[model samples]
Target: MLGSVTTVEGIHYKTKEPVTIHIEHGRIKDIQPIAPDKNNDSLPWIAPGLVDLQINGYYGSDFNTIPIAKGSVENTTRGLWKEGVTSYYPTVITNGDEEIEQALQSIAAACDGDPVSQAGVKGIHLEGPFISPEDGPRGAHDKSYAKAPSWPLFQKWQEAARGRIKIITLSPEWPGTIDFVERCVDQGVTVSIGHTSASAEQIDEAVKAGARMSTHLGNGAHLMLPRHPNYIWEQLSQDGLSACIIADGFHLPESVLKVILRTKGEKTLLVSDAVYLSGMAPGTYDNHIGGRVVLTPEGRLHLAENPGLLAGSAQLLPWGISHLVKNGLAALEEAWDMASVRPSAFMNLPSQNGLTIGAPADLVLFELIEQRMTIVQTYKQGNRVFDLTTSTKE
Candidate 1:
């Protein structure tokens, strides 16, 4: 058995005291608080590795556009590991039936019977084909194929996935959507709302039908709306609903992000709606969504013709955690929770607590030098997957 011991005293689960974590064979063996050690004083904060429930692609791979092969999925999974993402749901949005089936088949093949594959890829998040038809609300999704939820269609997709699809996102206002959400819930699949123009009443009905999450809550809608009585307010006030926000600093302004962190602490999860252009050098690129988008100097994706409209985000989970910390929106611990514990719970994953003995040995170590968080190491099942000190090698 291989093992390593790490003592982190400065920030443990958002606390000030130092905590020592023991790992053996990719499982957390022990966790305890201890007095600071002079030798370990330089070590920075340690926390559970991040989990993102909605990631389209990273490091130049677009889940929707890339041919689903083990090599493609493996490359994408490895790319995410470098960002400290221990686990994520590969989001497949708005695509044709054949394309969706091919993508799902690829993911299942890549994940089957592989340990590292299991570590990062939980399952698929199907995000479209049942969204609103409005141009603005559809938010870059292909409108030609957009349609109302159909039970037969869902059954076909689920069959094509061979039970690998875990979550589905749709607009509740669509005909038969409520029944579809209920059916999906009954079948043990999560249903989330997105690309929607649902009213408060429609949202409530969907919630009652078992839609518990909102997909990228603030990004896929009209820019201006009645301040107090908007979809944002409705989602915020719903106690049972959990939402994900793209904290890449572009999807939502700092002030709005602060408000969300404050009001939805522990209730809100963060996602990188990162596209194919993520992690690539800044330049103009073609979005498979049939439009030209530019990778901004600040690492955000914007529509080439209309800079006001964001194409997607290049930020990963670590950057999101730092955004929360830098803006004072959440305490370091709280930000970590958004990235780790809360998201796991949202997805009903087995390991929801951070660094607890007997939990999966997925962890991230970072130094907060001068208030900037930098990932120093990443561990998956007690084995080092990413070490910034050395180049990434399989």
Candidate 2:
């Protein structure tokens, strides 16, 4: 339907129809259904490239490792292209004040110096130092630095990030949570509740004060809590809060995931929450959060000494999406949207338009063989960036 444009053809990820997408000037120009060809069976599925809201690092690049090596962020950006991530938030977890400021500065510097870093690093996700210091609810974050929120301290880090800190995850159990959440909202920063042991009333107050989301809702919490009115239940009850779940299979079971999907509906979004060891082979490694963690052959990352305790998520969004589909927790289309347009819409990003006449041409082509998703090609702004058939691919 569009004139003289470079077109990409594949089966639509949602409709399952063979179509040709016309691209021009870095956006979608038109999309038209095409008759199935003899080789249609070999064509990959096409959909919007993934948008990850929480990711620490990838491959050997660790964002939490302060004074991050030069080119690390840039390398990670290109590395994720093979996995179909077009936009992502580089997460900075709980740490000493000076260390956290330095980490933000390094990331901001990377974005300022490199075009690739600027393109991929949508914003910074400040995940704590303001979270709960309680044992189980603290998850793997270091407790020594956990403290109450301070607007002045946060302003210092924001200055280091050059105003790129878009999301802050904190616990409402702290005394000044309402005021902090309000200030963050006023600055156009999204406040997400996480790592908490907050009571029902505290959660309600935070939601009323402008906390709009939950960071990996089910993971950062007390392992044991009363069944009646827990923080998890409270977050689930808040229709105003969007739920971000780690569907990596090791985090939440099918039933809970189903409940979240049903409760949140269009508000459900997926986050990788992946630590630095995500793409590494199964092995033991020194982690910043947990003293020593082991990445199992099954891809689960757990504390080495206590095999039963999870250290952090080692799988990314593609694997999480695959797990949901493999377990019948969500349809392929819905699972894909949870990692794509749904998250984009929650963040109010331009990619939320998704597969329409004028959406950004951030697209991916992939296969779903045996319920496992594999990226065949990825395009950002209508330009092919990764292809499976090439040696340059990851």
Candidate 3:
């Protein structure tokens, strides 16, 4: 039982004020304002532990590469908890049907009898197999394995996922994709547009068909494009689309990042898009997508062939928040929302109980040391899942 839990509640979604959050048995019991205590050493700026809707892999473990073993999923969940992510969707990229099926099965089995596994692994994000086949737009995906959206094929994958597939990202302009988007929407699955070369009209149609998000908005496309007309601009201008951006500083330039933050504001969700190389020692490694990637000196993962092209990201949610705050792209509260509440809302989860009564006891404790957000602890369902000080000692 927490004696007196406190959080700094955001006022008007941009400013924070001290508020107490009481928890009992993994759920929020009460929330109330508290006077500042001079004797208390704990900082009051607590927030909900982040929820990542798109995570590929971390700590040298790729869900796509990891064999479907009993402990692999559990180990991955533990790794994610250390990064302050209390919940996330394990993203699976374009791959063979058999491989994808096996991954889903493993994830489902891992969720059994494990709270972190069950809570951390909300669902699966299928990122491809139905996407643009063009070179630049396809990014690191294998061209041979890419295919147009086929309901029959999707049905097979969905069955293998055992109804745990929550989101599917595909190109809206692909043949039969509009129908596919409709079908997914009808089944309560989110359809995101990505790896595309779609026209404005096609994008609009996809939105009408319930396509709601753009995956890694600016990372998968060609570097140069015709002025005043581009798919990036089209997607940016669409009011119905929420964009996920990799804020690892390499996927997009500072200018473009500022433009996106200013334009999208609360509509933008921060995604790591991290690969297996994340949290690993710096060196060259072969991405499963058959390209050579180098973990850079500055700690970013970049495509070895084209320095401009990003292989993936190494940043986590807390790091992204700190970067955004340091760069003046957004206020600390807004950045926190992007990492925590916005993504949850986008995934259709409740944004309430963020230090409020009757909410889940999913919380993060951090301090701003010289304006840097440093995570000190992470709590899931009222259990202390991660503590940086404790982990460091071990």
Candidate 4:
């Protein structure tokens, strides 16, 4: 149980043993197993704070909204903390030049102003404007603003964002993209292939140019395609490219999720790809991008006018991890690694901070009951950022 001190006792994520973690100066001081405390009602499992590489928004706050609402970014970070996410990328999708500029500037200002934003919002994810204009590959992004890749434009956005844009997702089919990828990699920014209709040869060229990841691998493509030589299979076959899957059960079928998990193995990661309506009530709602969309009782978010195509997801990373575990797609430890260890490792960030000494004290205390996960508490840098008892939590 959490007390008035920085030392916390729970089951270690790796060893599955009861242990006590001592924290000092916002870093883990030591981890030692202690005798079982019979008084504890729930044997909460302690794991590294979950990291989400792509999140558009949560609750009623949309990260892409121009002239960002007051406290919107802060509110999103706080809401994610309750869901066990301590680090994430505030994803901005396809939009007009002015809207993208303002959104990135607002994010940079928010991070500069608040400690919570600085701790949780690791960087910005630009997911569009350089993607395919086709219906299936474009997904829900506004095609009017979509265009060929431009290095100068990205530099301007990076300037406005104060160098916080770390990941840029684009289609490799566009001309000059290979050169753009090379430039971005030179600057330490991760380039991911997404929203594309690129052929296998083009995919290989992207990898050669330093594209390190595939953004939401299975979702941003035509529903119907040739079984062979598809982008999904091509990405799956590439050993150098890490793939991020939604895994919320709504984005990809169970069988497909299993194949991607098995194929990618340790290189696989989980991304929410959650839109503005993620935590909102299930009903027909007018969205800025997907127009009229319906959030179902079972948490499926799809276009109301056309139910065939999904608008986005309505779940978070923790929920996705639970779904993977309960469906037998992965063991509990492997599923958790997809959300924490794998993503952090791919991002070049330290992994397993919860169990490592001298690492940041960011962690989540949760329990699995009847295959459902419950987040009991969350600590970021030795501070109690979220607790189950707080009513204003989400």
| RMSD for each of the candidates | 2.5, 2.6, 2.9, 2.0
Predicted candidate 2 versus true structure: per-residue lDDT over 1-394, tens digit per residue = 0123379999999999999999999899999998868888888999998999999989888888977877778888888888899999999999999999999999999899987679778899999989999998888788899999999999999999999999999999999989999999999999999999999999999999999999998887777889889999999999999999999888998899999999999899999998888889999999877789999999999999999989888898999999999999889999999999998998899999899999999899999999989898888888888888783542
Q: Least accurate stretch of 10 residues (summed lDDT) in model 4?
A: 1-10
| 10 residues in a row with least lDDT, candidate 3 | 4-13
Reference-based TM-score of each model: 0.93, 0.97, 0.92, 0.96
Rank by lDDT (best first): 2, 4, 1, 3
Worst 10 residues of 2 by lDDT: 1-10
Q: lDDT of candidate 3 vs native?
A: 0.79
Q: How much lDDT does each candidate structure score?
A: 0.79, 0.91, 0.79, 0.88
Q: Rank the candidates by TM-score, best first.
A: 2, 4, 1, 3
lDDT, candidate 4, equals: 0.88
TM-score of 3: 0.92
Off by over 4 Å in 1: 1-11, 226-228, 392-394
Prediction 1 global C-alpha lDDT = 0.79
List candidate 3 stretches off by more than 4 Å: 1-15, 40-44, 66-70, 304-308, 351-353
Best by TM-score: 2
* Span of 10 residues, lowest total lDDT, candidate 1: 1-10
TM-score of 2: 0.97
Q: Highest lDDT: which candidate?
A: 2
lDDT of 4 by residue, 57-95 (tens): 999889987878878889999888888898999999999
How close to the true structure is residue 219 of candidate 3, measured as C-alpha lDDT? 75
Give the per-residue Cα lDDT of candidate 3 at 62.
79
Cα lDDT tens digits, model 1, 234-312, are: 8877777888898877788998887776777678898887776777899998876748998878887888999977888
